[model samples]
Target: MALVKIIGCGNPLAGDDGVGLKVIEELKRWGLPPGVRLISAGLPGLTILDLMRGADQVIIVDAVEAGQKPGTVIHCKETDLARVTFRSLSLHNIGIAEALSLGRLVEPEAFPRRLDIVGVQIAEITWGKADLSPLVAAALPLAVHTVYNILKGGGPYA
Candidate 1:
């Protein structure tokens, strides 16, 4: 059986930047499949490495500012991460891309065989803000569905 891990990363205080954490919270209520694990990996950084290690497959959900309209949910493979620029509101030395790359190098056997990212476009990342923007809030269900599809063996972006 494959170990599928869903890790959501973001800062809960940074407005729309917290969409990842919100999605994770929503998923908890819906329940999860067998062999699947969910993690609220806030602010990522080096913590993602630990969260992903030993997983056969991994899905990371986070906010990105890639010049798209706010609330747009984008699905991408691990290889595609290099093309998309992630938005960071925290002071992390290493972002998701760097962390995954280092993880693969440090533990080839433990590194995930498959990896995907569910990114939501953000309109703002203002400090002291705890709620998501209306646009992003609306996209949460779609993001959750997308992650569900992937975990059910529907494949990436199904």
Candidate 2:
């Protein structure tokens, strides 16, 4: 089991909603740190608990509809994620907030001690959409850097 786990959640077919997956794809080129595991968890609901088990810390990357400007990146800690109410009309799966809550309830000891969410404000999410909006696409590098910093011991969760 890794010490740190990075899970990217999204559906690649849903326009800008795929930012998390896209970031994971990009990260594949850079060698990851030791004791770090990367997972591209597409639309994972309760399965997030399984993926996070045994890790000391977890960083989740996902597209969020927080009504912020397109391409905005919001960093949320575990408490912040717990407070967020994920109400969306899209046909996406259960959100990170709910997943983490359930994980904590089910297995507190196996749950990660530190959880962070790097949410990129999404412009649109639709079925059969293959590409991201320009704004959301522009935020990809920023999200990647943010995650890298976290892994490097210099981000908010650090």
Candidate 3:
């Protein structure tokens, strides 16, 4: 059974870092396909592995600092994450890449069969910032659509 899980990771307290949560919010309102679970890993940090457990396919939406323009949608496979060890992912102290690497060491079989990462390039990650930047806000629809296409459409907004 292919259990597709969309894991949105971020903290609303940080500026553009919260884009992942925003994507999750909009996806929920759009009435996504049944059986496709949406998990908000709001600053999950080290607990990310637990959120993704048992998922046959996992799509992680987060904010990344790729030196690209704000609102840029970056798509990547799980393996690609390790290549950029210096670049941070999701504005966390320990990035998603590090978490996944550590998880693989602890429980190799617990990993998903397939994994994809859809990231929104961040402008800034200031604490106490509760809103997205103008450019990031404008790119919400595209972010939503990117996630939808990853699902390969099972129904509306799919």
Best by lDDT: 1
lDDT tens readout by residue for model 3, 72-126: 8876677777554224463576788888889989998998887778888888878
Q: Listing every candidate in turn, what is its Cα RMSD in Å to the true structure after a full C-alpha superposition?
A: 2.0, 2.6, 3.9
> How many clashes does each candidate structure show, in the order listed?
0, 0, 1
Name the lDDT value of residue 132 in candidate 3. Answer: 94
Runs in model 1 deviating more than 4 A are 84-91, 155-158
Candidate 2, 1-158: lDDT as tens digits: 54998898888898887888888887887768788888998888888889988889998888888777888887768776535532222444676776677778888998877888888889888778979999999998888889888777654531
Model 2, which residues run further than 4 Å from truth? 82-90, 155-158
Tens digits of per-residue lDDT, candidate 1, 12-109, equal 99898899999999999989889888899888698888888888999999888777899988887877766666544343567777787778788778
Clash pairs, candidate 1, are none
> TM-scores for all candidates?
0.90, 0.89, 0.88
Error (Å) of candidate 3 at residue 136 is: 0.8
On the 0 to 100 scale, the lDDT of residue 158 in model 2 is 16
Candidate numbers, best TM-score first, in rank order:
1, 2, 3
